[model samples]
Target: MSGSQMGGAGWEKLRADIQKSQFVLVGEDHGIAQIPLFTAAVAREFKPAIFVAEVDPYVAQAVAQLVAQPGPATAYLRRYPEALCFFDWSEEFELVRTLRAQQVQLLGLDQVFITTSAPFYAQLAGLVKGKVAKSYFQRQANKYQAQNQAFEKAGNDDFAMAKQPQSAIDSLGLLTQQEGPAAQKMAHDYALSYTIYQKQAHQLRVNLMKQNLVQALLPYQTATGPAAPKMLFKFGSNHLARGLSQSVKGEFYDIGNVVQNLADIQGQKSLHLYIIGKQGERAESDNPNFPAKRVGTYTVAENPELLPFLSQVAGPAWSAFDLRPLRRALTTSKLQLANPSLERTILG
Candidate 1:
């Protein structure tokens, strides 16, 4: 596989190509911190028109609005931590701050809420009125209370139904036949489907998320914008990869595939950049002054083969290493990433 280090003239080559892309999906290992630092640099250089996030669209939109209005970023985020829980204090926060500083647009595409959906559902329930819808809402409210009571009596923590309410909108047709206002039925149906099937449900949510993302980015796909609608999708590896996911069932259409298909249909270009962590449990370096050692962050766990090359990676970050020279140094070398397919998947 042909690869280039991120610095020197190498970064210039990657930047030239990346800046031309209409849609760019960058994969991440979620819990890692250094990944965001690399991404921040990319965003600064790439200056994509918009950032497509792996968060709830509704909450993401709200946060985007908040970010655009001004005020402290962290304070605003902490005020409504439920918008996208995982993104709260993680490197995502730094990403958000950086993008906001660059005046980049933020669009969240996921439908699932990390915490309880009751708050959002309650708002939807309030928008309509009718016997069926009211009854459905009342019943669900009572059911939630009973469940909490049961857990209290049993000396257990109250469990929440974290599932999305997409089915309720579908159920409106059936509920309306029960002889009530269509508006009420719509609300009632959505509330009823707030149950989880775990794996299948998660798969469905991700598929729907792709649709949401494509729809959200469709307008920006036009020939306008400062530079042909450059967009960056920062998501988990499973959500951004163009390959099968053992985590989800059925035919999974991840965000990357969705964007790729969309770009193809529109005669545009997209790139899937997957970033992987080291393959093993390599301890953080004890050398505090090591230039590559990130402050308060773990070091990339190098695989056995990369162990010899690990010394080449400085403390600042992987973005600093131009892997091209390293690769040329050893023709027999193959990247031993946690995601074994990454090197072949991209640089190949």
Candidate 2:
């Protein structure tokens, strides 16, 4: 544990730890711009082969395209404000750009991708062979296009499509089967992720997401097997933990479990970091109009209880505390802050 101003010592240790590892799970308060700014800084420092995010694969692709497009970011915002609206955080625009600019391959670990990017599934209708499967996706594509129009016309309530049917799922399987090798790429691509979304509708969401992570990361494995492609997985802490979560209401195996397994294979280290906002004037965090560049930071007298525990952190309001030492010594360091507002508790 150290002060937020531990300076070079903090980053030296943090980067050293990251260098000795295969996957880093960075848990953050949802919609906090500060976290993403810190994340961009981490990515700049670590330069991992892949940056895994708790984002839709389609949205990631869209942002990449927008970045490469001849127009400004606002063009993207106007056409697909839903992407930013989904997270309700404008600052993520920087994270997307940072990762893309760094040439770090972006992988969206979430399995659910439906409705929001219908054009993807719709276009898949043209790519896949076979009449029956093609017809099924074609119909779905048209329906999704109509839904998009209606959503825009009705002021984009932000919810466009839902409830993929068994028939649609079955048809998608057949479509992928018909497409063969091409379908494999499509299945993992923006369009086919919806099929995954539909499939994971009932399963523990993190399970499929971990599976997706495994598939994307397998290529980075080396012959020596001690080191694989380094990765940073950022998501809500709930989605990164393992074992049974009574709150989530099921037996859950998340990214933490996935990384542990990866460590077992590569013989590397893995960590499960839980972030909590402690002792600050916490307001509602997910503001669409908040600074798009970074989460705003303000000064506060560091609390005595926290001062002794947290190491140097980057964000203005929150500091990065190395909890690994504490995890080894204490069985639990329950971080539910005493001040409720500072916690930035979110419900999804």
Candidate 3:
């Protein structure tokens, strides 16, 4: 309650590192209210030119437009409750509004959500020429509506896009061929994402995300190969680790590692922080319709190196542990630790 969103030496240390780092990445657990609060504080301090989000590219575009005017966003959510994924949370909405107000570029680089198909199709419909094509897009939009509704009611893939007929998919692909470049790109990404989901292709999904990050930054690059705009990436912990992701058993280098390499090319550093609740009741289910059914305790300080930071988590305030020094200690062999695996987790 007293610090910079929870003040003390730890917060000061983290802020100092943030001041100097070109990229500040926050890997967080979903369904925590304090996360948005703390992240907003980081936004103010970092003043990043770009804010990378966890949602899909089109959804990010929608969020940027919706948050520009607060009242319409609320109304739109009421009608299409799951139109946006992570930002559907009230706290996340406020955080996006904060970033929008600061004039930060919001970039979403992930797979499209099932419930957002209707809105995405509507966007595609608006971009194309001619009445017949427009009508076709509208019909697809309606199908998406029906599919989403059925999936929500039964919570099954039986009614999902993955099960759609091959002919239907071919028709859409053919329609996109007739559309403009912008519409074509959207359809291509969506189709690739659909295939990934259908096959449960985790590596392909990660590769797509890396490609999206490159595509999002292309405009800023030139013949001279200048650095990308200063950015703050907010994603799940698994997606933001430096080298190997625990989720993938050390097989994949995710978006966080991608950003790190980019920063290294520019002779700058990317700061990655993993944030979670000290202890609290968390949402049992991501769906808003699912009632809060249980209380849980979450913490990331079980390791001895993290114990100092744990003590800084005072009532109603958060804590920040600057892992850079600990990371340095490991690389330089300043601290004697016998376990190699524990060293990697701490370094991460």
Candidate 4:
């Protein structure tokens, strides 16, 4: 993708696009320290009434409570380390602080119950608990050990012959035709394992939806005006897909499915979804696919609107913004937009 310049006019256009929308989804590339700055900038421009984060409600509630108290915002970081996993502390703190100052309600969209253990245990129970699940896990361990031993032997032979690090050679060997069958077998086994894990994750996601719906409805239930103009949902692209689908094979549910289910239960069609993703990286087959198009690039001169905001936060000196990095960011933002196909399914 070519790096194009976005000027003040471009920023205004982007702001206009955001203002006209009822929902804005911002997808991100890899979890980099700078990504949150862009998120905050966009949020500042749009000023959505609600900011939905990937963090679970339990953590969000705790953080929200902490924000309500008067002190350095960084103080809350020490209390909840896991919440920092999604974004850098300083950027996230700034975003949270700014949002709170503006009185924008923060909503937690992730399910609280979907722990790593839940899926493993659920699968274990399905496989017959102590008898089948334990045996399966043990067998899996043994198989991995054998593979590791073989890989080590191959690495040793390559290193001995070439007198260099065997990492690249080892990686190449693993991707060769000889390894294809083994890779397929591993994939199949992973699928089976994932099936068990997904059941538990799905259950947790459903529970989260129930809780979020109740919370979001409270204000509307009490009174009614035109209703909030827009909502901004910030989350991993995976959950925003057509349903609450995990990357685990058959276990994935596209966000679309979740929305349809919600509409069926609520008897409402007022919600609008905007899926967003950033560009810069090539799309991986495993990643959630979306109807994506280039939305231009972010250049230092073009987005001068961001200059003041970026300056306020500490970061690397701003130079010419590379188109590749900006594209990657935009591609991610596009993916966050709710899938239109899923939306159609629900509305129809």
lDDT, candidate 2, equals 0.57
Query: What do the candidate models score in CA lDDT, each in turn?
Result: 0.55, 0.57, 0.75, 0.44
TM-score of each: 0.61, 0.68, 0.86, 0.44
Off by over 4 Å in 4: 1-12, 68-80, 83-88, 113-200, 221-229, 242-248, 251-348
Considering lDDT, which of the candidate structures 2 and 3 is the better prediction for this target?
3
Give me the displacement of residue 45 in model 3, in angstroms: 0.9
Off by over 4 Å in 2: 1-16, 70-89, 130-139, 152-158, 163-177, 184-203, 222-226, 242-249, 278-317, 331-348
Per-residue lDDT of candidate 3, residues 1-348 (tens digit):
332264667788888888999999999877777778888888888999999988898889888888888554666655454677878776787788888889998998898775676777778889888677788888887787776666555534333466666676566678878778888887787787777777888889899899999988888887867579889999988788787763525577899889989988778989888986666755444344334332345655433444545666677655555666788997898987665545555677
Clash number for every model?
Answer: 10, 3, 3, 41
TM-score-based ranking? 3, 2, 1, 4
Per-model root-mean-square deviation over C-alphas: 8.8, 7.0, 3.4, 16.1
Residue 37 in model 1: shift from native, Å? Answer: 3.6
